[model samples]
Target chain A: MNVFVVGVGLIGGSFAIDIKAAFNEAKIYGVDRSEDNLEEALSLGLIDYISNLDELDKADVVIIAIPVDATVEILPTILDKIDDNCLVFDAGSTKKKLCSTVEHHDKRRNYLAVHPIAGTEFSGPQAAIANLYRGKTNIICEVEKTAFKLQEKGMEIFSRLGMRIRYMDPSSHDKHIAYVSHLSHISSFMLGKTVIEKEKNERDIFDMAGSGFASTVRLAKSSPAMWAPIFKHNKENIIETLEEYIANLAQFKELIENDDFLAVYREMEDTNHIKTILKGIA
Target chain B: MNVFVVGVGLIGGSFAIDIKAAFNEAKIYGVDRSEDNLEEALSLGLIDYISNLDELDKADVVIIAIPVDATVEILPTILDKIDDNCLVFDAGSTKKKLCSTVEHHDKRRNYLAVHPIAGTEFSGPQAAIANLYRGKTNIICEVEKTAFKLQEKGMEIFSRLGMRIRYMDPSSHDKHIAYVSHLSHISSFMLGKTVIEKEKNERDIFDMAGSGFASTVRLAKSSPAMWAPIFKHNKENIIETLEEYIANLAQFKELIENDDFLAVYREMEDTNHIKTILKGIA
Candidate 1:
């Protein structure tokens, strides 16, 4: 099998590496706007060939693993260029907008709108890995629009990559993902920004941060190029979630100010159930 | 040596278990408000005897591992009851009030204020483990107040437990910890509350939570009884920190509302340096 991956950053680049590891006979091709990322992917042997849309003719499968904004922008052109048999898929964090954007395309049946629910706070071709997607959930939306053969081909590769496939409507995926994944990025970036502003000294932050602080602030390091568009696409839901997040923070702030020990404790105690919820999902 | 560990919940209980496990000859005694916690402690062999203030004469060392409020309220009583040669340490998060409470006590020489930077969000005796403190840093405030002999003893025990002991003033410890640990709990708890409010259904949360959300919100599951008082004691610093946090959220929220993709991306891009900082500390 041959795979042509666009963007060649963390998600695409990592997928390329992992796919080749899973299927030794597979040949991977890398495509990206950045020469450095493409070079790194090739040097790392994440790809056997590097080319642009001109080579889409011979590609067996095409993966759009770029940031959400780029994925939405370039998807239509790629769809127009792909052959009828190409198994097209995307690893975007959001789905509704991308699926809707390409819903009317001639090659729409060739695409599988997918979101593999796994990634670290890191990004770029250098951050790619062989096992980045193993044992994680891969969300597939609007599958019926995809031809049976194409969907099956994508699923077989995803299964080989060790992902658990889940099905959902694009709208539902967007709403739920806003709460679970998108809002977390916003909260983390804000938390990091807040402390950096308050401390006014990076040195102080470096000296004092413990493991808990590091884990909580981890996502603050994610690529702006990738996340900015996610927040933009999921804006309404992100804003609604943000308002709720700020309200919760304000309520806790008031409880702390009043020295309302019981209220503060009970509020935190109430949210402690997140442990069970998180553990169950993992 | 005989060690009396009061309030043997997660922190104290784990400490007791590790201490006993590492040193077979040390006699460990347990005291707690919960009969079940004490029974669990006994059944786990974390301690060798059930003792109290009435039996204070038996312990050559006393470890107060209770809520911050309780530690401030009980330290003087426990200090006055202990033998002159005995070393007493409190494994509480905040140290300002606890240290101040024992400032002029004659036996202040016997009391050491220590905060071990190790724990999970889980609580109680069942959360006790043999090696929670290994390779972690434990902060000891006002070590000069503790007599050289007892300080040496405490260091030996912590060292044998595979912990690194760093010393600082109580006032500084309280302020720095607000940024490093307590503030993290507030941010995470509020994040959990925000997601809960938005989702309005636990099932949605269960199905959608990915590893990113899990690690980011891990601190939200921490025991409120343990955290509220820590915030109460460190209120001023926490308020300043919380205000900065709110302001950061507002700034990010406005950027999202305005579609300032560059600002959104750059903010996260800048904060990503936390990866370098975390790499150094961890």
Candidate 2:
């Protein structure tokens, strides 16, 4: 089997490593606009060789794992080039734009929109690791739009990578991810900015930060190049979620300012249900 | 040496376990208003036995690990009951109030104000673990106010627990901690609250949440009983930091709303410095 993975960064690079392990006989090809990433992925043994878009007809499977904006621009073109028997899928954070771009394409049945719910704060090919998809959730949007044979092949691949699959419409996937994923990155980035702006002494941050602070601020270290497009593609949903988050912060501040310790305590107690919710993810 | 640890929750219970390992010959006594916690601590072998306030005089070392409000109410009394040779210290998140409360006490020389910067989202005696303090920071405020002999002994204990000691004035400690620690907790709790309020489907949250959301919201699960007092005691600094955080978030929202993706990208790029800052913490 020939598998071509485009945009060899964290998501694509990790997929290449894990998929190769799952199917040792599969030949994995790497494609990236960045020469440095292609070099890193190749040196890391994440791909057998560097390939190009011209080779699309030779691939049995094509995985698009780039920024959402880039994925939107290139996904239809990739579909235009792939052979009829090839299965194509994208692993972008926001799915509505890409799914809609290919909604009426001649090869629409060959393409699937997927968001594998996994990642670390780090990025680049160097950040890829084996088993990243193990026990993680993979959301497939508009799966019914894909050909049945390609869907079966996609399910087999996800099962081999140890990922559990869930299906949703593209619009619902965008809304929910705006709350659970995109908003978190923005909150953490803003938190890091606030702390850096207020705290003059970096040494104090280093010495005083406990595990809680570290965990909360960890996402602030994510790649801006990768995330800006996601926030752009899902602007409306992200904006709505951001407004709600700011209002929540404002309400919490008012409670604290009013010396309403009971209200503050109750607010946190109510949010503690996230613990039970997170256990499901774990 | 005989040691007495009051309020055997996460911090106190972990301290009991480590202190016992460090000084095997020391008789560790547990004291708490909560009988269930006391029983749990004893069963976990976190303490040699359960003791009472009347037994304070029998202790050569007294460690008060409780809520900041309770620490303010009880620290002076613990100092008053301890013998002149006994070393008394309190591990509370907020230090300014506690330090000022005992600033002029006659036995102030025998007490040390310490905040060991280590913890998990969970609490109680069952949450205690060995080496919780290993390689973590221990902030000792007003170290000069402690007796010379007791200071040496305190250093010995911190060293044995594998903690690096950083000394600062109580006011400075409270301010820095508000920015780095307390503010992170509030942001996380509020983020969790915002998401919970908006995302009604718990299953969607479970399936959609990536590791970034989990880490960013992890502290929402922390004990409300423990954090409310910390926020109450550090209200001024916390309010100041919280306001700055809200302003930063508002600014980011404005950038996103105006479609200035470059500014959003640059903001996150700047905060990427947190990666270097966190490496110092590790």
Candidate 3:
């Protein structure tokens, strides 16, 4: 099998490594605008060769793993260039825009819209790790729109990567992701911003931050190039979540300010159900 | 030496384990208001035996690892009952009020105002681990108020647990911690609450949450019994930090709402410096 991965950064680079491990005979090609990322991906052994869109004719599989805006802009073009037998898919965080772009294309069955639901705060080819998708969820949207053989092949790849698959519509995927993934990034980024602005002494922050603070703020380090587009693409759902989150913070703040310890205690105890909820995540 | 841990939960139970490991000959006693916790600590081998406030006369070292409000209420009484040569210390999160309560005590020299900056969301004797404090920070407030020999013994205990010590005044400690520690907890709890309220399907939350969401909401699972008191005692500083955080979130929301992707991108880019700040924490 011949595979081409677009935007050879964290997601694409990791996919290249894992897919090669799963299918040793498969030849992998890297495509990215950044020469540095291409070089890094090559040195890291994440790809078999560096290739371009002109070579799409030879690819049996083409995975789009770029920032969502870039995916929105270039997905239709990639679909137009790929061979009919090629099974093209995306690992973008948001799915609605990409699904809509290729909805009416002649080779629509060749394209599958997937949100692999995995990543780290770090980016770039250097951050790529093998088995990044292992034991993670892969949400496949509009699965019925794809051809049966291609869907079967995609499922085989997901299983080879050790992922559990779930199916949803593109609209539902966007809504749930806003609450579960995108809102988390915004909360963490704002948290880091608030602390850095208030606590000017970085030394104090370093000395006082326990593993709790580190875990809560870890997503603040995620790439803005990636997340800004996700937030923008899913703006309506994200805005609703952000407003609810802000309101919750305000209520908690009011309780604390009024010295209503009982109310504060009850609120936290109510939220403690998250313990049971998160146990399933791991 | 004889050591008594006043509250044998996460902090106290873990301390009992480490202190016993370091001082093999030391006799460790467990004291808590809950009989269930006492029994669990005994079964876990976290303490030599169950002891009470009356046993204070025999303890050469007394460690108060309770909620800050409980620490404030019970500290002076524990100080009044302990032997003159006993070295008493606390591992509470807040320091300002605890420092003020014992400011004029005749046995003030016997007390060490210490906050070993370590913990997880889980609590109770079952959560206790052998080296929870290893390679973590210990913030000692008003170290000058402690007598010389007792301070030496306290430092020795901290060293055995593999901690790096930093000294600060009690007021400064509470102020800085409000931003770094307390505020993180609030953000996490509220994030969890908002998601649970919005996402009615537990299965969807389980399926959709990536590691980032898990990390950001981890502290929502913390013991409300332990945290409520900390928030109540440090209400002033926490309220200030919460307001600032809310304002920051509102501004970010406005930027997103206005479709100003550039401003949203810039804000997250600025906060990305936290990646460097967190490197020094570990």
Native contact recovery (fnat) for each candidate is: 0.76, 0.78, 0.84
Report clashes for each candidate as comma-separated counts.
Answer: 1, 0, 0
The better-scoring model by lDDT among 1 and 3 is 3
Residue B3 alpha-carbon offset, candidate 1, angstroms? 1.0
What DockQ score does model 2 reach against the true complex?
0.82
Q: Candidates 1 and 3: which is better by DockQ?
A: 3
Candidate 1, superposed: residue stretches over 4 Å from native: A200-207, B21-24
Model 1 chain B: lowest-lDDT 10 consecutive positions: B197-206
Q: What is the alpha-carbon lDDT for the whole of candidate 3?
A: 0.92
> What is the CA-based DockQ of model 1?
0.69
What TM-score does model 3 score on chain A?
0.98
Q: How far is candidate 2 from the true structure (C-alpha RMSD, Å)?
A: 1.1
- Scoring the B chain of model 2 against the true B chain gives a TM-score of 0.98
Instruction: Give the residue spans of candidate 2 off by over 4 A.
Output: none
Error (Å) of candidate 3 at residue B91 is: 0.6
Candidate 3 lDDT for residue B9: 92
Model 1, A54-164: lDDT tens per residue?
888888899998888888899888888888899989999889999999989888999999999988878888888878888888899999999999998998899998998
Name every residue pair that clashes in candidate 2: none
Chain B TM-score, all predictions listed = 0.97, 0.98, 0.98
List the candidates' TM-scores in order. Answer: 0.95, 0.98, 0.98
Q: Give Cα-based local distance difference scores for all models.
A: 0.85, 0.90, 0.92
Model 2 per-residue lDDT at A47: 91
Best by DockQ: 3
